[model samples]
Target chain A: MDEVKIIEIKKSVFADNVKDADALRAELKEKKVFLLNLMSSPGSGKTTTLIQLINRIKDKTRISVMEADIDSDVDAVKIKESTGVSSIQLHTGGMCHLDAEMTRQGLDNLDLEETDLVILENVGNLVCPAEFDTGATCNAMILSVPEGDDKPLKYPLMFTVCDLVIINKMDVVPYFDFDLERCKKYIHLRNPQAQIIPISAKTGFGLDHLADWLLKQLP
Target chain B: MHELGIVFYIIRDVKKVAEENRVERVSEVVMDIGEVSTVVPHLLTHCWRWAADKEELLKGSELKCNIIPAVTWCDDCKQEYETVKHGKTCPHCHSENTWLLRGNEVEIRELVVSG
Candidate 1:
C-alpha cells in the first residue's frame, strides 16, 4: 500500500490579532498608560468630541491623539492646531478599519513612552472598526441621535462588545425622533455592563462628565 | 474595504507556515468566515487571485472559504436562533434579551499540502 500522509492543522488566521491585543494590553498596563480605541460613524462628531476631551484633560495629563482615515490628514492638522497636542495621522491606505497589528504599528510610530493617554480615532465606521480589537485598554463608540434608535438592533455586535457607548448629538434629541430610553434598553440587551452616556459635541453638554468618567478608567 | 491588504496578510501567514513545516508548495488554504464578520468572501478570493499568483509557493494554490452561520442566544427563552434572520430578538419568544453566540469569525481553519 502507498504511504498516506495527512496533517491536521486547525488554526485561526485572525488569532494573532487577539493574542497581540492581549499582549499590548498587558504592556499598556505595565506602562500605566491608558489606550482608548474610539469608534463612530462619519459625522458623529468624533473629531469634535475628541477636541473637547483633549481640552478637559490636557492641563492635568499628557495626551496624544491618532487620527486614522482612508486618506487625508485634515483631522490631524485640526487636532494639532486647535489642541496643540502631539497628534499623528494614520493612513490605512484603503482599509475601512484598523486591526490589532495595525494599531500596534501606529502606537510604535507615536511617542508611547512620553504620553500618558493614547486615543486612537479609528476609521469612521460602525461596522468594520468594531469587528477588530485595536489593542486598547478600552473601547468606546458614539451613537448620534440622528442615527436613530434602531441602530442598536442593526449593529448588535458593535453595541455588545463596546465598553462604553456615548449617545452624541443629544442637544437635538427633541427635534429628532430618537428615543434615548429605548436605545439604552436595546444596548443593555446586547451588553448589560455597557455604560451609556448622552452628550452633544456641538453644545459641550456632557463633555465634562465624559472626561471625568474617562479619567477614572485610566490606570 | 482593503481586501487587497487582507490578501497580503494571508500570503505572509501562509509563507511563514510553509517555511516552518518545510513544505515546498501549498495546495489550498481553507478559511472559516462567519456571515457577519464584515469580511466579504468573494472579495477576499478576488484579491487572493491577484496576489497569490505572484508568489512561487502559492502560484497555483487555491483559497476556499467555509461559511459559518450566525446564531444568537436569547437570554429570556434560553434558546438560540438565526442571527441574520431574527436579528436582535428571539424568534420563538420575541424577546430582545439576546446575544450573538456565533458568527463574526475570520479564521484560517485548515491548510492542505501534499505528502
Candidate 2:
C-alpha cells in the first residue's frame, strides 16, 4: 500500500476572471467603443435615462444596450421601441449582479465592431452590482432624488465605485424636498472624482449635458 | 444576495484542486474577503454551507473567512490609511480625495483536503 499526501493549494480563482475582464476591456478600448456599466436601485429611472440617451445620441453615435434583470425583457422591449437601436436582454435568472462572464456573453450577442457605445443596464440593486466588474470602461450610477440624500453614506459602495453619478428625478425634487447640494456633498464625500449630473428623465431636463458627457467619453 | 453564485465559484475551484491533487475529500477552505466587497460574511457562510454540502468533495468542510480591512491611498496627502467602519474620511489629510488601494476583493485563498 502506498501512502498519499494531501497538500493544500493556495490560489485565487477570481484572478482569472479579473484577467479576462481586463482583456475584454482592452478589446473594447481597441474597438473605440466606450462601455458603461449603469447601476442603480429599482425604479431609479435607469431605463428611462437610457431611453433618453438613446434618443438624444442616436444620430451622433451607434448605441447598443444590454439589459440585465432577474426576470423579464420588459425594459429591453421598451428601449427597442423607443430608441430603435440594437439592444439585448440578459436574464441573470435571479443573479443580483452582472459578472464579467455575463457581460462577455452579452457582447457576443451584439456586433461590437460597429457599436460606438455599449451601455450595460445592470440589475436593479445598489450593492451587488458594485462588487461585480463587467469589463466596462466606466461604472455609472443613478441615484434618484426621491431615494434621499443620505444614500451615499448608507450605500457608500454603490456611489463610491461609480465614475459618474446621475441624480435623477429632479423634477420631483420640490415634492420630496430633496436637496441637490446635500446629495452632491454626500457623493463627493465618498468619491471626490465622481462627476455628478442632475437630470430629469421624465421631462428631458439637463439631458443635453449628459449627452455631451457621454459623447466625450468616446474615442 | 448573490452569495450563492459566489459559493458555486468556491466549490468549483475546490473540486478542481481536489481532482488535480487526487484528494478524496476537502476538509477546509480558507477565503480572504475584503471589508468593502459588498458580500455579507454571514450570508456567504450560510450559502456556502448549503452549496458545499451538495458536493462530495466539499461535504463537512470547514469554511474560514479572513476579513481584510479597507485601505485607501490619498493622492493629496501621499499616504495610505485604513478606512475604519463604513464611510470614514481620511485620518491624516481629512481629504476625500482618495482611491482604494486594497480591501475590495473577494477570492479563495487556500483549500485543505484529505485522501
Candidate 3:
C-alpha cells in the first residue's frame, strides 16, 4: 500500500493568467499596438458601435478587429464589410471567455506591424470575461438602455473591471424607462472612476465623444 | 459553463505540480473557495469529475472545496461584517465606502497524492 502525502500549494487560479496578461501588455507596448477589450451582453449593439467608431477613426489609425465567440463569424465579416478594416474571427471552441493566452494566439494571427489599434470584441458575456484579463490596454463595456440602470449593481465585477462604460441605444431611451442619471449613479457606485458615454450607434449621437475617448487612449 | 473553464485551469495546475513532485497519481485536490468568488461549488465539482477523468494523473481523484466566509471592512466604522448578508454596504455604519476584506478567492490550497 502506498502512503499518502499532502503537498502544500496555495495559489490563486487567476495568478498565472494575470502574469500572462501583464507580459502581453508589455509586449503590446513595445510593439506600439493598443488593444482594447470590449465586453457586453448579447445584442448590446457592440458590433454596431464598433462599426461606427472604426469608420470615424480608420483613416488616421491602422485598426483591426478580433471577434471572439462560442461559434460565429458574423461579426468578423460585418466589421470587414462595413468598416473595411482587417478583421479576424476567433472561435473559443465553446468556451465562455477568452483568456490572455487565447488573446495572444488571436494577436499572432493578425498583421501586428500594420495594425495600430486591435479591438477585441470579447464573447457576449458579462461574468466570465470579467474574471479573466484578455491582455487589453483598456477594458470597455456596453449597457444598452433596454438592459436597465441596475446592471452595474447586478454585475458589480463587470463594472469594476471596465475603464469605460458606453450606454448605447440612447436614441430609444425615451421609449424605455431608462433613467440616464440613475444609470450613471449605479455605474459610479460600482466604479467611481469609470467614464460613462451615452451614445446611439443608430443615430450617431455622442459617438464622436466615444471615438475621442478611444483615440485619446492610444499613443 | 465558466465552472468547466475553471476545471481546466485546475487540471493544468495539478498536472504541473504532479510532474514537479514526481507523483504518479493524485488522490485529492483541495480548494479554498470564497463565498463571493462567484464560482458555484457543485457545478465546479461536477465539471471536475468529467474533466479530471480524462487525465491520467487526476483519474478517480476527489475534489474537496473549503468554503471561506466572505467578510467586508468599513473604513468609516472601522469594523467588519458578513459580506453575503450585507453586500457592499456596511450594516452597522450603513456606509457604501466599505470594501471586501476577504472572501473573493478561488485557490488551490493543497494536493493529497500517493508517495
Candidate 4:
C-alpha cells in the first residue's frame, strides 16, 4: 500500500510543561515559599553565591536547593557538605535546560513543603535555561566580574528574562577589566525593571542586601 | 544546545502521531517558531538533521521552519509594532510600555507521513 498524507495539528509540546509549571508556581505561592531560579555560565560563582546565601539565611529562613546539571552530583554533594542544606541534584542527562517536568520530579524527591525558600540552580548555560520556566517565583541571572560587561548585550535573552542580575565575584573586579557602569547600562537597556546587585561570595560582601531582597519577596 | 532537546521533542511527538494513525514512517515536519523564541532556525535544522538520521521513521525527513514576526501592542498609542529587530520603541508615541502580542511561541504545526 502506497499512501501519502498530511496532518495539520497545532500543538505545543511545551504547553503541558508550562501548565505544570504554573501549577507548581501556584502551589509555592500558597505555601509562602519564594522560589528563585538562578541561571549563569559555569564558574560564575552560582554555587558559591548559594553557599554564602545558605550560610547567612540558614538561621533566618528554611532553605533548600535543587541543583540542575548536565551530568554531575559533585556540586550537590559539595553544597550538602559545606552548608548542610538539604539539596537534591537533578541530572539532565543530555538536556541543556531543566523543564517543569524535571523540576516537578525534583520537588517530589525533596520535601519542599518543609522549606520556606527553594533555590533552583539551573544548568551552566545562559541561553536555554532562560527560556525554560521551572515554576520559580522569580528568575535571577548571575554575571561575574571576569565575564566582562558586554555580556548583557551579547546574551540579551538571558539578561532580559531575569528579574534580578547579580554581579558576582566583585573581589576580583579590581584585577579584571570589567566595566560596572557599562554592565548596568546594558542590563537597563534590555530590561529597565531588573534589580542589579554586586557582591563577592568569597569575601561575604553585598550579601546583606541580597538577603534583604529575598526576605522581602517571601510571603 | 537546547535545539537538540527541542528536536527530540518534535520527533517524539511526530512518532506518537504516526503510531496513532498506523503510519510506518514520517516524511516531513513543519514547525512555526516565533522570532523572539530564542530558538535559531539554523540551529534547529542542524539538530533535526542529526536527530532524524538516527531514527528509522524519520530518516531523510525534511524539517521546515516558518518564522513568525515578533509583535507587540503599545498601550500608550494603541498600535501594534514589530519587535523582531530590537530597539522597537513605539514609533507613534515613543513609549516603551508595550505588551507582547505574539512572538514567544514554539510549536509543531504539521506532520507528513506514509501510512
lDDT, candidate 1, A3-69, per-residue tens: 3233355566666667888999899899988999999889998898999889988987889888899
lDDT of 2 by residue, A46-152 (tens): 99999998899999988899999999999999999998987899999878888888899999988877888899999999988876678899999999988999999
lDDT of 4 at A100: 83
Candidate 4 CA-lDDT value:
0.87
Clashing pairs in 4: none
Clashes per candidate (backbone, < 3 Å) = 1, 0, 0, 0
- In model 3, the runs with Cα more than 4 Å from the true position are none
The sequence of per-residue lDDT tens digits that candidate 3 reaches over residues A42-137 is 999999999999999998899989999899899999999998898999999989999999999999999999989999999999899999998999
TM-score of chain A of 3: 0.98
Supply candidate 4's per-residue lDDT for A3: 85
Q: Roughly what TM-score does model 2 have, to 2 decimal places?
A: 0.88
Give the chain B TM-score for each candidate: 0.91, 0.90, 0.98, 0.91
- Superposed by TM-score, candidate 2 places the C-alpha of residue B50 at a distance from the truth, in angstroms, of 2.2
lDDT of 3 at A7: 95
Residue runs of model 2 more than 4 Å from their true location after superposition: A1-13, B68-87, B90-105
Best-to-worst ranking by DockQ: 3, 4, 2, 1
TM-score of chain B for predicted candidate 2: 0.90
Indicate the docking level reached by candidate 2.
acceptable
RMSD of each: 2.7, 2.9, 0.9, 2.8
